[model samples]
Target: MTDKETYQRFIDWFRRTWWDLPESVHLHPMIETYLTPEEVDLLTNIPHSSQGIEEIARTKGMAPETLEPRLRALANRGMIYESSREGSVRYRLNDSFFAMLRAALWPGRTDEATKNSAPHINRYFLDGWMDQYAEVHLKGLRALPIDRTIEDKREIMPHEDVVHVVDDKKYFCVTTCPCRHRHNLDPDMPDCPHPTEVCLHFDELAHYIVNNGLGREITREETRDILKKAADSGLVHGVSNWKDGVDTICNCCSCCCMWFESFHKLGHSASMDASNYRIQVRPETCKACALCVKRCPVDALQLRVSPQARNKFGKAAVLDPDRCIGCGVCSHKCPSQSLRLVPKDQAELTEPPRDPREYMKHYLADRKAAAAKNQNTAD
Candidate 1:
């Protein structure tokens, strides 16, 4: 097919997929002038590239005046990026925005033709779409997980029970889990190297369990342990409810943390990658202080009696990788930094276990079946 024909096909797909419609009434005349339905189609059809406005306008047969302002609007809405090279301004679709559109358009689909089909969907989305508003919202919290320390007073609420802690001071919730998408970095951190980002939702789901009457209270200690286990297992980072009085915890990674704003723009989202790695400790560096043993959120870390000859430390901490989530919280607190985040290199990190198309096919099938069931119930 000709490039224009191919482009038109993509536009049709985008329109059907996102179901985005132009505003019925234009609040701004300038915005109205540039944001014609055709232009919107063009914008959506354009590949995620660094093409200058002139090139885009020429390709679309649009005048500069007609294109520039509309592009600005999309940029302001976080749909695309405005970039410059050698005094020339260019535009590209924002990764997160496109990902959201793709997700919305291709619900239940594991893959898109244009998107990077990585296992860590959440991390990839955040790395491409995170914004400052999200950062400000997160930074305003108090009582985050204590990094690199052991506390005797860790608590867990029952499955459905929630504890509220009102502190005179607010604390920032940061994590060492790999789910965080580091947007403001010099180089954007790729999505979770492991599946650690997906656990955030599950953590939130756990809180929903409480809200929906699934379980009773869980303690702060228990929450930490759960997050640690998820991280070690390469699950997403998660925390208990914050507005309801629980301390805020984060799932973070050194590579893609939202807090690392100066780095490449990592998209922001409420999702995480699937976890794959686990945490390990060097016994020699582990002091009998039992900081890791006590701080472990998942109960994966245990204090074992050391043999006299083998006892570099009177006691050593042992880790069960199977139960670990690789959040790297242990690494942050180890007095010797003996804890390390290790990838399960044997497992696939960059590639999906199944084709995204196949996954999507199954997902669509399930959705269709569910819809039919609902229809039957209504009938």
Candidate 2:
């Protein structure tokens, strides 16, 4: 009824979607800062599923031309998704994770509202909101090993190989890393030194992003170049936790990545599931440069005394297998080539769900079970 109630209702609507806000972040400042009473009111009329302008206009009880501009404005603001296929245009509300966070900032918008929301979004993630994602045993993302870091090429699956993942797509694009972009926007936050424009999208997702001006279309070779630059910067390759139809590959740094920061700063139990591979160390050949130790995002590697080590310090990188995510950032930069990712013991390996269909089935089941558990505890 009131403006406050209208905004709260919009927040409530997002809760029913794939990503629910944690209880502590019910009215997140970042959400409040960008959204307005008028925007919230208009968004309520938009459907979750895509529909044509005429169809939406009928629902609004207005002329199609009258309603089109409003819908286009929301789409431009990243509050809605728009697509054009075969001369027809359609629109739908973007999911909260994208609308409020990823897509909202990925375009590197310099507008006042976007800049103001940055610090609040960064604070929300760091404070407690990220724990909701970690509560589910099924992670949304999995580490993809860097190229040339696998110990045995024969063991690499198409999904596990970054090059194959890129090759599988017909379209490619690059966008600013929302995580790093957020931190870089906030003057109070520590400056993130890693490359920011390395978030890669492919296929239909790439089409949507580029069409919406969220990112720029790039050649596959350019995409690979971005991947190479990310690896050189000690960034981990993170992709959707699925075996097929993976749409995104985020070049994540421990300092600003949502998943990595959730694990490293918020003390979440886990950020992402490890790849099927784990680092294999050759202590005898280890130069003990400690690059791997420094590069490991998960604190998985440490330099310790090793009689077998050939380096001056008599210390070599030792892995806490439990902590390694098999991301290969460490191995990619190994000067002595003493570290490489090898297939985990078959019994310990985890293959991601076959595709988005299977992945969401498992994800929804986990969410439902977690909700039930929390309700029972409350009772």
Leading candidate by TM-score: 2
Candidate 2 lDDT tens digits, 88-117: 999988887777678887788878889988
Kindly list the per-residue Cα lDDT of model 1 for residues 1-379, writing each as its tens digit. 5544544454444434311222222212212222344445656644466698888888768898888888766654334556656878787654432333221111122223112322223343343323322322222111122232222123321211112221211332222232232222113334445323222222332333233222334544554565555445432233332334333344444344333331234433222222334566677766767776655544468888765314555777788764554444565556666676544565543221133344345444554665587799999
What is the clash count for each candidate, in the order shown? 69, 0
Candidate 2 colliding pairs, count: 0
lDDT per model, in order? 0.41, 0.86
TM-score of each: 0.33, 0.94
